[model samples]
Target chain A: MGIQLDFPAVLERWPSFLGGAALTLELAALATMFGALLGTLAAVGRGTHNALIAGACKVYVETIRNTPLLVQIFLVYFGLASLGLKFSAFTVAVAALTINVGAYTAEIMRAGFEAIPRGQIEAAEGLALSRVQIYWHIILLPAVERVYPALTSQFVLLMLASSVCSQISAEELTAIANYIQSDTYRAFETYIIVAVLYVILSLVMRAGFWGLGLVLFPRRRRLGTPL
Target chain B: MQQNTSSEPIVSLRDVQKSFGPLKVLDGVSFAVDRGEVLAIIGRSGSGKSTALRCIDRFEKVDGGEIMVCGHRVDRPDVDLRALRQDVGIVFQSYNLFPHLTIEQNITLAPCAVKKMATGQAKELARKVLAQVGLEEKLHAYPEQLSGGQQQRAAIARSLAMQPKVMLFDEVTSALDPELTGEVLKVIEQLAADGMTMVMVTHEMGFAKSIADRIVFMHRGKVHESGPASILTSPTTPELRQFVGTGNLKS
Candidate 1:
């Protein structure tokens, strides 16, 4: 017996797939921004002289990183409902994804922070810059620029992982793909198209990040240092 | 504490002591720099010259001694570091300019942030200092884009912009090549001729001989010998004679 391929049947459901892709992008965008802020703060917190804050950040990163993402999604979906805290599936998806990706971001950013040479901070101190100023201009921004590639990669993975939100009825790209395949009984074609859509989205996001990086770190661009 | 009188030394370290783990880096080290006086500290590697310089800026805490800089008690734990640093500017061997910022920003950052100087004032100050270092045209250039010589000059300009009472240079030209070192030395020489109160730790026997009002030789964490620049030509200590004896050096 021979198997035949049919992409048209899945392509016919373009509008539904487009809506799902848009929703997926929306979820990823929200999670990405919040995750970055939370992650950067967590990274700084982990490096503090305060024992309590550092320990707390350590525990947060460790617990979230070791556990599965699906469980985290389910916990936000059902556990919140059980506590009478009902939010739309979209909101729940965004929250869960932010919490999940934030841990990874913290680790990446911490490595970036640690990589900053001691001379940089010492130079800032010698200049008499305030503690806050040293952290912002000397430590955080340069560290972020140094680790920009790792950060962008983590964010792209976050966009792909938005697919898991489908399990919680978040109605993102993967959820829409499931509905289309079931309706037309064309599972293989549906997934193939979804995979291709994901690749395009990743490329688009990477391009956008590259442009932003150039604008954000003109020094790197002028020096011809690749992001 | 009483205010510092004009006749008083600008910086004084009285029997300052410092240790690193099991190693004692500074032992009963004592020295002082006066207004418009240039002091050069020369010693072999691991002689604690840099450590003693760092202590003047409170970069390293003295184990047991009194350090007075511009009337601030540096040995006290509660000393206002910002105020102390505002009066003392330090330049390091590695330039240490903020790579992410332009030269203009690097020079103006401390003044604008600490003194709350107006933007126009800081810009004028940056321009003036860059002019002083003969780097007036490289205002917008990043540190990495400049040559090592240019970068070192820019670092000196950055310290000058603070309008400090005293400047500390810790082997400022140690990391530069001969050509670059000459360029940076010229700037320092001009500063000394301008009568800026400064203490420098350096290994350039020639530069120290010509520019220093006094040269101090440190050996084994102690002041082995110290006096006028003429002392290099006629040493009173074997340690210093051996140090300057290595070559027929001249600036």
Candidate 2:
């Protein structure tokens, strides 16, 4: 007899699957916000004239980018535990995802910063703008607008990778799938549903980022030119 | 005709020396612009005309020299750059208007950020300066939307909103075609007619001859000759004669 599929058994745990998807999104959102901030700072710090600060920023970016995200999650999870620090699995997942995404973001943001023309900074200086004013108005804002697409894609990728948190039993979508599959003995159907949810999550994140980009860089929309 | 010999110069550079490693860009360059006077510096591409103009604004730190502008000593390390820039307005050939900002925003940026003017006040100032540049209609347009000449005019408007004591033009029309160059020069002529103290480094010898109070011919990183507008026609030095001979200066 042919093997029969049993999607109904997996579909019975829709509430658990819904809760898992919500947690996955929450983790991704928290990690993205913190990662963007960390990345922008590191990008600026790396471009600074101070050798020590720039060197430190460079080392952080290179080290995190070269290693696998799985290794980083393990290091943060086990390393913090060994250091006598206690935290929930969710916290550890968010922290590891943030750290992982921050490095990738720094590299992307550095390219954005590098793309700004030297003349723009010189013109700002000529206007007698203070250092802070120049950085915010002339350098950072336009640079971010120019690289908005690349940045949003990175965020989307981070959201998909958050599923790796399932290994630590962080109770995300994949972890929920693992539990439901074992209980119902419908492993294939459980994983297929989980994959669909992840895809939906990524599409939602992309739409959200695109909307944010439109608001943040309205000039690009108006002029059909990169800000 | 603009020789008012009694008043103090608003901008002065004496024995200014600048070197790029081994290449000496400016060697003992000295000049001065009296109040409301228009001094034009003319020379070939690498004659250090641009360097001398940049030094007055402290854009390039002079290796050795005394540079003063509007009573501020520019060559000294302790000189406040922000204050110096406040008193000086400069426009470049490329017209470096911020691409992200609108024309009004470009004009109002300095007055708003540096001078801390209110948004309403800055907008009013932008209106006035944009009008002066004959670009009142382009207040909401982006830099990329404007033609090269319009972009350059907007740059001048942006500088004028600062209300600087002196204006510096570094080949402001070198990037424009002849027809577009005329429109920009017209705005500058109006500025001169209004008695603004100005110094310009230009290849447009014709415009220099017509509007400049005096001209300094730079050659081989030094002042080859300095005299009134008549020098463009007379050309006492051989370098000036050769420079005038080139078709680029068709006065």
Candidate 3:
């Protein structure tokens, strides 16, 4: 039998799809902010001279990057519950996504940090800048500027990967699609609509990051120069 | 020259030694810089001239002996390094200005963050130093926006913003064009005339002959000759004569 087209049937569930799309975005924003903080800290930790701290951060980044995101979500959702720590599906989704993306962010940030020259740090030292001052002014801010594009792209991927959270019935767009398709008995139509929504969501995220890039790195925007 | 209460030597390295892995860069190097005096260190590449300056700022840890900067011993394991660095400023050949910051921000960062000065106060001080470097008009310019000379002057301004007791210049003008070199060298000469203590590692024979109070030549990580600039013009040592005779001394 030829595939029957029923986009209109799935179109009737637009409100549910819209709501699911909004929640996906909310989950992405929350994960991006928190994950960025966690990742930056991990990057600094990995670059430190202390072997123990560096080793631990290295292990965390490698372990997360090596494992599949599906297994990670399951582990985070069921593992936490098994430990008697109950969290809502949305909360678990955000938590799992944050943990997963934080590792990639760490590696990207570490590359940014390494790109800073040894001479710059020595110059900061010669100026009598304290360790904190040197790290913030010479290292951290410029590193962010150098790697902002990479960082933002990773966040967009994180938004797409958030679809995996549907496995736990997180009530995001994919989960909503599963619900609507079963109710309307139109799996192909529901999935196609949901897939289009994801593409729109990713585009929106890309635009948002581009705007943020303009704001955060005004030097680059105004002068057309890299920091 | 007579010494005043506040005019003690700003930098004194006694029996300093440094080694990287198995190779020794500086072996038992000792030198001193009197307050308000301009000292020039001349040496072939990798002869420890730059390494000696780095030791004064504790950028390179000394394996043995003591480095006293503004009366504080930096070689001690328990010293407050950050505080020590606040009194000694250094300029590099690459002009290592923070490329992300504007000239004004680059100059004011250490003062506001490390010295804990108020932001307004730091800005005022930065403006004054930028004016001193003739870069007051370029305060908002980034490093790449400026010419090589302007960037070096801005680097000098950044160090001067700290109001350091001593300044170390590691071939500050080497990276600039000949015409551009004059602008930076003029600023250094003005600082010397104003009685700022400075130790400069440079190949500029004219700068040394005209501005320096003492000239020291290093070879193979050792100070081969130490005397007045007149003596450097016609050095007693064979190594010093060869170094100054060849145009290699003029970066």
Candidate 4:
């Protein structure tokens, strides 16, 4: 007889698969929020006139972007443990993901910031707005509006990339697949199911980002115009 | 060329000089705008007209000399630039309306955040100012949704919401189409009739002759000729006469 597939055996552990999917989403959400904040700050830092601050931000962004995310996770996990800073694998996973996504976000935001016209800043100054007011009103808000589509797409990619967290035994979807496949002796079916779950998760994240963009920038929706 | 004796001048620039590397944009420029007076600055491109206006708001820092807006010395190292800005409202050639905000939000942002007015009060004030600019119907429209003239008016309303003591206009109508330019000019004319203190940088001689309390002709970063609008019609200097007589026609 030819080799037979044991698909039912994998389906029997549907609860475990579902739990893994949920954990993956949770990990992605936590990382995305913190990464966005980190990225915005880094973008601002890169744009600042201060030589030291701008240089440090540039170096940080380049270093994170050029290296592999897998290495970063391993470095964060083992490096922290070596220093006796023992954080949970989940916490380390989130940290590593945040660091990785933040660099990409910073570059996207910087491009957005650069797109703002010099005339606009001069106009705001002419109005006698305070520095914080200028930043929020003329600089940051409009820059975000201009690059919002790019930023949201990056976040969705970050969610998909969170699968790499399984390497560190984070108990997310892929990690759960590893556990279940070995237990049930059904490697191919288990991996295939996990891959489908990742695809579903990515779609959900993209939809959520699109919805958030609608709420945050109602003017674009009302006018049916590009920012 | 004497200062107005009726009221205190709200803005004064004395011997202000600004340079960009080798290019000198403003050289020994001096002018004053009295309270409730409309002063129109006219010059060809690169005549330092816009630079002189920017100096009053400290948007372009003066390399030499002093600028006083509402008695706050702008050139002084210790002066609060932001506070000076609060007193001087400026309108630009390109209406720099915040793209992300509705007209109402753009108008109310500074009043609520900078002035710390309550949100209700800010909205009410924005509505009143929008009405003043004939844009009450556009309170919810974003800048991208409006015509150029309407966008400029909203920008003017945004500045007016701050309740600045002096308003500076840098080629405010130059960016609009002829018909659209008329709409923006009409709002400015109303402001002049209402006795708002304003200094305008423009190439519109006809509008300036009709509305300006004083006409200043800038050439090569210095005041070439300055007097009443009647003087602009028959200027004394050859350069001023040539600018008003021919330049106005070509434009």
Candidate 5:
């Protein structure tokens, strides 16, 4: 017999679901901003002439990217606790997520940086632009523009992956769903709603990023194509 | 007329030598471009003409010998490259314009960043240089939007915005269509007439013969033959004979 479905129980908890989604967005937004900054610095560090700095950035990207996010979350949670330091679950989750996504963003940004034509850098050098000036104008900005799509996708994935923070009692969307499913004994119905909420969030994020791309990269917009 | 009142060469390479791994690109080549004089370097593809031009800008470090540009000893270990570049402008075969910026922005970037010019002044400078290159109307356009000839002109304008004492052109028109080449050459001719001290490695014998006050012919990484523009018409070496007498060597 096909079992009876009870979406009404989940729908009645719309406030809780919405609150959870809001918290998820908060975590994702913070992570995306800080992670982008950290990743860009790491990408630049990787390309620098100093061996020690490049090696350290390499280790960070490799270790973070290779390990699971769940393990990272637990490490940040309990590892801090064991060190006689304590932070809120929300803080721990954001720290974990930022650390995780920064690695991926770094790799994506590095590929973008490498894809820039050598002639571009040479031209800038020939013009007597300082090293930092060259990196900022000729290398970084155009590279970010060329790989905007890749960066957007990685950030969206990071948002979805924020669900794993539930294990650390982050109370994000997934944690709330876990609470509701167990409380109401409506696991199937609760999960379906959460899945739909995730889909909606991802779409909202993509649209927001697409609009940002239009503003930040006017050249690409004017050309109506990737540079 | 004495173009240079000081009678000192503005750009000089003294027995400069450079090698790329197993290949000797610039082998003890020496040349000097006096202030307000146009010097053309002509040679075949493998003759190291481009490398010699590059060394003057320190783009290629010479293995031996010295390079002096605008009073900066480029061969010195502590050579101030930025200072040297500020006084010397270079254009290349490829326009190498920053595609992300407008023509105006591309021309103003170095001046504003390096010279600390205010935005209003930089914009005015951009306008002046763009006018010099006959591209004042295309200032707001991105590089990709312009034709190859227009892009090269814009590149020249970008260099001119620095108001350099000396200009280096490394086959600046070699990549252009025959029809497009004339416009770029015309811009160079104007720069020469304006008394810009220039050292250009060129393949356009006709353009070189007309614009160059002196010509340095390179072969096997050495100055095989060099003299006034008249040398292009009457040569003294067999290489020069076979090059200009029978057929233009493109070398």
Candidate 6:
């Protein structure tokens, strides 16, 4: 027999897989919200007339984008340890993922911000909207609406990439799968099940994001075009 | 109208100069509009008429000279932009309504955010302005859903909601089709009839002649001719004659 199927062994250990998946989702959710906030701020910073703030934001985006996610996670995990700062792997994973996704989010958000017509900002300015008001109501909200699809995809990718947290023993889905596979001696079946779970998680994420998009961007929902 | 009675100018730009790198767009341009006067600036493309209107709103900072609108020194470095803008409203050729908001929301945004009006109070103001623009029914509709004329009207309503001391229209109807242009012009005419102080940069000679208390014709980045609306009928300057003649030829 070239190979044998033993999905039952993996399926019987559903509690561990379910817990791992739940933890993975929690990590993704935290990273997504925090990352989006950080990215949007960074994008705004990059657009500012102040050279120093803009330059710093540019450097942050470039450094993260240039480095591999695996290396970032390792650095975050071990760097904190080397500095004598004790932290759980889960905390490290979320921080690393947030930092990583924040960079990608910043780039996408910058594109969205750039796409806003100059007239809109001028109009807001003419209406006496303060700088912060203009940014919140006119620029940031519309920019996010414009790049929502890209943002959601980035989040889904972040969720999948969260699997890399297993290297730091983060006890997420992949880590649980590794434990289950070794215990049950059903490596092939365990991996296949985990893969299917991942696909299902991604599908659920897409559905959630699509719903969130409809709620967050009523204009887009009504017209099928970002405002 | 205030031009006929009041001596005070709500908007005054004196020797305002502006340039884009090496290109001088507005050279020593000066104009004033009284509390209820409708001053129309008309000229060919690249005549700096639009730039002058923008300077009154502080949308474009003058490279030199003075601009004072509604008691604010626009040319001064210490001038408060928000305060100056609150005293003036400017609408552009493109109806730059916030695409993400409904007509009502767009109208109410300034009043609520800038003026610090409560949401309910802002909504009432929105309803009133939308009614003024004859677009009360479109209160809930987003900008993209409206026609070009409707969007421009909504843009006007949005500005009107601010209740500025003066309003500036930068070729607001130039982007519309002939049929669509009529509706936007009608809204402006209605506002003028209500004695709203206004300055407009327009190419519509008939509309301008009918509504404008005074017309300033810019040629080669300077006010080549300035007088009553009758200037369109009897131009003292040959440049204005040629300008109006060509304008009539185009239409």
Residue runs of model 1 more than 4 Å from their true location after superposition: A1-12, B1-5
Model 4, residue A121: C-alpha shift (Å): 2.5
Better of 5 and 6 by lDDT: 5
DockQ, candidate 2, comes to 0.76
TM-score of 5: 0.96
The CA lDDT of each predicted structure is: 0.91, 0.90, 0.89, 0.87, 0.91, 0.90
Per-model chain A TM: 0.95, 0.96, 0.95, 0.95, 0.97, 0.97
Worst 10 residues of 6 chain A by lDDT: A1-10
Interface RMSD of each: 1.6, 0.9, 1.1, 1.4, 0.7, 0.8
* Model 2 residue B17 CA deviation in Å: 0.6
Residues A1-227 of candidate 4 have per-residue lDDT tens digits of 97678889999999999999999999999998999889988998998889999999899899999999999999999999999997889999999999988999899999988998987787777666766778777788668888988898888888878888889899799899999999999999898898899889988998898888788778777777777
Per-model fnat list = 0.56, 0.73, 0.89, 0.87, 0.67, 1.00
Off by over 4 Å in 3: A1-3, B1-7, B248-251
lDDT of 6 by residue, B10-105 (tens): 988888889999999999998888888899999989999998998888778889988878778999988999998988888999989998999888
Give, for candidate 5 chain B, the lowest lDDT window spanning 10 residues.
Answer: B242-251
lDDT of 6 by residue, A1-227 (tens): 67768677679999998999999999999999999989989999999999999999999999999999999999999999999999999999999999999999999999999989999999999999988999999988788888888989999999999999999999799999999989999998988888988999999899999898788888877888645
* Location of the lowest summed lDDT over 10 successive residues in candidate 3 chain B: B1-10
Tens digits of per-residue lDDT for model 3, B1-251: 22345755788988888998888888888889988889999889999999999888888888999888887888988878878888888999999988888898998898888878999999899899999889899988889899999999999999988888889999999888899999999999888988889999998887888899998888888888998888676889898888888875443
Better of 2 and 3 by lDDT: 2
Tens-digit lDDT string for candidate 5 (A1-227): 99889999779999999999999999999999999999999999999999999999999999998899999999999999999988999999999999999999999999999999988887888899989999988888899998888999999999999999999899799999999999999999999999999999999999999999889888888887568
Q: List the residue pairs that clash in candidate 2.
A: none
Please state the error at residue A79 of candidate 5 in Å: 2.4
Writing each residue's lDDT as its tens digit, candidate 5 over B1-251 gives: 13336777999889998899989988888989888999999988899999998888888888999888878999888898888888888898888999899999999999999999999999999999999889989988999999999999999999988888899999988898988999999999999998898999988998889989999999999999999998898888888777775556442
lDDT tens digits, residue span A1-227, model 1:
77788988779899998898888889999999999989888998999999999999999999899999999999889999999998999999999999988999999999989988887788788888888889887877788898999999999999999999999889799999999999999999999989988998899899989999889898888887532
* Pairs of colliding residues, candidate 5: B43-B251, B44-B251
